[model samples]
Target: MWWFWTLWAVVALTHCSAMDRNKDKALKLMKQTPLIDGHNDLPWQIRKQFNNQLSKVDLNTIQTTHTNIPKIKEGHLAAQFWSAYVPCDTQHKDAVRQTLDQIDIIHRMCDAYPESFMFATSSQDIMEAFIQNKTASLIGVEGGHSIDSSLGILRIMYRLGVRYLTLTHSCNTPWVDNWKVDTGTEAPVHNGLSPFGKQVIKEMNRLGMLIDLAHVSEKVMNQVLDLSKAPVIFSHSSAYSLCQHKRNVPDAVLKRVRDKAGIVMVNFYNDYVTCSQTANLSQVADHFDHIKKVAGHTVIGFGSDYDGVRRVPKGLEDVSKFPDLVAELLRRGWNDTEVRGALGENLLRVLKDVERVRDSLTKDQPDDVPIPYEQVENACRTNYGYFPLDNTGHSASQSPLVLALATLLCWFFGGSSYSCRP
Candidate 1:
């Protein structure tokens, strides 16, 4: 009986030691660095609840949202892009108006609490916000479709302080085939970009806007990267090699992004990070490890699709749980510099490069009238042959043997292959 008591005491003491270690590690990580999330829909959430109806909830004490002044303070979220997510659909009569409304949400938040939040267009602004103990609120348009296929509208958005524009969302625009829809069955419509799309890239480059390729097809991503004068940003995406999700960036693409001096912000959606259909924290870490192995430290950052993704990694449920991620990285042997880069510096570098490109373009002006829509479409028609997996030289070829080998390897290793079921 006495021996049994001794064994129980030893087990209890071991458990307490383990808990204490985890706590200490978490505290150390929080003090070492400030976490910067690349994407969140705090503005979208605000718009969804109070779309021009400010009476519904007080902006000062927004009680019922994942991200707010109080929650950001609690989470230690030093900076984040308050995404201006406009859903892709032709049904909206005024796409630009809708986009403007989303932008207004951020403006309202900044106006309500100048001390706690500040709108940041450049890296310097972000740093200043940090110095002031304010969360730097940056803006990014979720879909290119918000511009209504007009370069004028794109310029207007840029002038309105929109920094990044996701080239495509779930739906492919008239100028690009979406990866979700482009299954290599029918002939590619826009291939990667119509001539109009090229103009869009040029305009974005000219405006210093970071051409976001997140949600675009692989072919589109390649074309945008080829055309953009500045480094690009994958605002919200993960490693496809780990989970095989269509939304995640593959190794080959990641390599090109690195070569282009671009940054691929790691996503936190469970489906993208892990093979699991549900949120799983451990599997999410695997994605970070895989991306680090392939892309190196320079190319990694966070792009948590908060409010955009229904399910998230278990430990990273909301903005408040960001500290948990910092702790996880520390456990994985990441030092302060590496953690800080992953959190925000890497993304800031891309933003600065975009600004430089914009500045260069502003210095060069053309006298020729803007190309007509018909001529743009005609130019794009010729490029449709650039479609992937099509007879076009750009298409990737698949081999049956490779598929067979992959199946065999999966069975041999774990008897299950990574799939994005949810």
Candidate 2:
């Protein structure tokens, strides 16, 4: 009996020792290869903390934030797609202006910390930033609303070094339904991508900007996979099969992403990563495992969604804890190469492919024309009829005067006017 007890203790000790060895091994692997996180909301954090002023925040040390210069270094983060996120509630023109402010903050933050950060607009730029021991700062606009139905704005965003643009956020864009609305939280505006939404993808390909499908409905995701000339990404999403969250990517979508040779960078938000309320670091690894199994190892990567979500997985509460995830993957039998791919290689490959598509389109002129404003506004009007806003700000859904005016306008406009249904 004593001998049996001793043997059990030895077995447990050996298992612990093995875990330590794998964790150590994972850390070493991260140093050799860069860990390019697809999304981080530090720019928003700065907006909240310092009112969009970089000087008010000291990133060199711990400062009540998930992402800081020191935390980024500790996490082995080589490159980051800083989210130029503006709330979807800030509609149309205001959303566009706020997005510009977010972009400006990102550029200034990178410039303010030149020694610790360097701006990266291309895959090569990311690698160069890594080589220089600086974290690459790549910009990713969070919603299509930022462009305000203007292809010209999209082109300008890309020229300003924006590498990716999420097709929608929590709310549906005029041309696309978002995941949240499609999940029944709200009425969907465009059941999927409308004609104009497809045009957005084409312009993105022409400009070399990666189409981020994080917050879009699955219908939109499938539509994009079918139409995009370049590989697309889900900048910060998890596997819906694992957690059943609407914010997560479905299995069917995962396979499509793999077929496109694109990547789905896993999100680390506790709610998205796990079905259980208590999310641990291991659950984060579980998402990586599930995506790799369903999508193949080539298309798996990390997006983290750091500073974006209110609750992060335990042990991955900040950017500094990234090595912990790498260690978990190693413990789960992932090889150094596969681990490296999840860390950054897969995203690099996709970004390079997007750039190649853009280069192929260099001779093509920009899709610079703006989609007409009234067309966007009336896209969801029932029976092609709209309710006019009264002086007190109430919508007059059945005003005879409004209906008569709409009929008169339709008669004069001809083809541009939609026929009002009874």
Candidate 3:
């Protein structure tokens, strides 16, 4: 028994030593380069659990959730795309307001921890944060519902420092189908993308927003690959070939993403990683490896859905487990270059490229493509708007009520309102 105990102790000590070495190497690489994660739902978690009260919740304290300042520091995360996730319930009603609140919460979260976090909207900002040893908190809207099918709302969100927009969630927006289309659970509303949805992609390109295809249907994914001029990303998804989940990216789409210079940021939810409730770190790494095989290493990144899912992979249990995954990659013979790119460089390059596309479209006027009323007309929708424009795009409506209002305006404002040119 004494000999057995001694042998077990030796083996345990050797294992600990190896893990320590791996952690040290991973930490060293991350310190020099920015380790950016594509998606996190800490904002949503804070909203639900803490009532959006940062004063009541301590980011420094380790809570039951996956995210906390201590775990984030331990994770060596240089940049994070905090998801401003509006629920499907808010889609037609108040998704925009909820999304705005989420963004505000993220901003406040950064402000609360000024020393540890800072708002970042570009690759350069990420690099600066890396140099300054602060977490670059970038914004990502988790669903197109957040924009309520309005390009105007989308533009405003982009102006608010939201760097990416997921085209769908569990529910489809009026202009796009969600993953349910592939799962055979819900029929697609837009087939792939409505004409308006295509415009959303174009507008996002012009705004330099990274088009996130995580929760979109397979048709939508293929459509976006064909449509978007800028590099797209699956901000938090895994390999469909492995998990067989509709939320996961199929291998063919992964190849297409590679061709388009897009990236697929792997998700770490146990179900998405292994198609089961219980999974391990190895399973999570398997997703990265499979996506890398199909999409190439440069197109693979991390997007642990921290605080978003309840069941996480075992070894990658919390935000702090990022280095462990990196270490696993190193053990699997991933070179420093591949590891570095996956850490942050690849996503950063995508950001710069998207920005360049926006710059090229600097003189291009915004395409105000509106969703056709027939397509979206339902009990859920209300037609409160008047003055719908025509092909000439003039002040369109001349209803008697409108005319009476115009007559009053003309009487008051020196007859200027009578002009139809507006």
- On TM-score, the leading prediction is 3
The TM-scores, one per candidate, come to: 0.81, 0.87, 0.89
| Candidate number of the best lDDT | 3
What candidate 1 gets wrong by more than 4 Å, as runs, is 1-34, 59-64, 90-92, 182-187, 366-422
lDDT of 1 by residue, 253-354 (tens): 998898888988778887787756686666766777777889787788878888777788777777777766666776778776777777777887888888
The alpha-carbon deviation from the true structure for residue 419 of candidate 2, after best TM-score superposition, in angstroms, is 32
For candidate 1, the C-alpha RMSD (Å) to the true structure equals 13.4
lDDT of each: 0.74, 0.86, 0.87
**Candidate 1: residue pairs that collide:** 389-395
- Model 3 TM-score, all chains together: 0.89
**Decoy 2 TM-score against native:** 0.87
Model 2 spans with C-alpha error above 4 angstroms = 1-12, 377-422
Better of 1 and 3 by TM-score: 3
lDDT of 3 by residue, 1-422 (tens): 99999999999999989878877888889888889999999998889888788788888994868899989999999999999997897766667888899999999988899999989999999999999999999999999889987888999998899999999889988899999988788987778998899999999999899999999999999999999999999999999999998899999999999898889998999889888899999888888888887768989999888888989988888889899999998878788999999999999989999999999999989877577766655333444463475565443644456546645654565445423211
Of the candidates numbered 2 and 3, which has the greater TM-score value?
Answer: 3
Model 3 CA lDDT for position 337 = 94
Q: Return whichever of 1 and 2 wins on TM-score.
A: 2
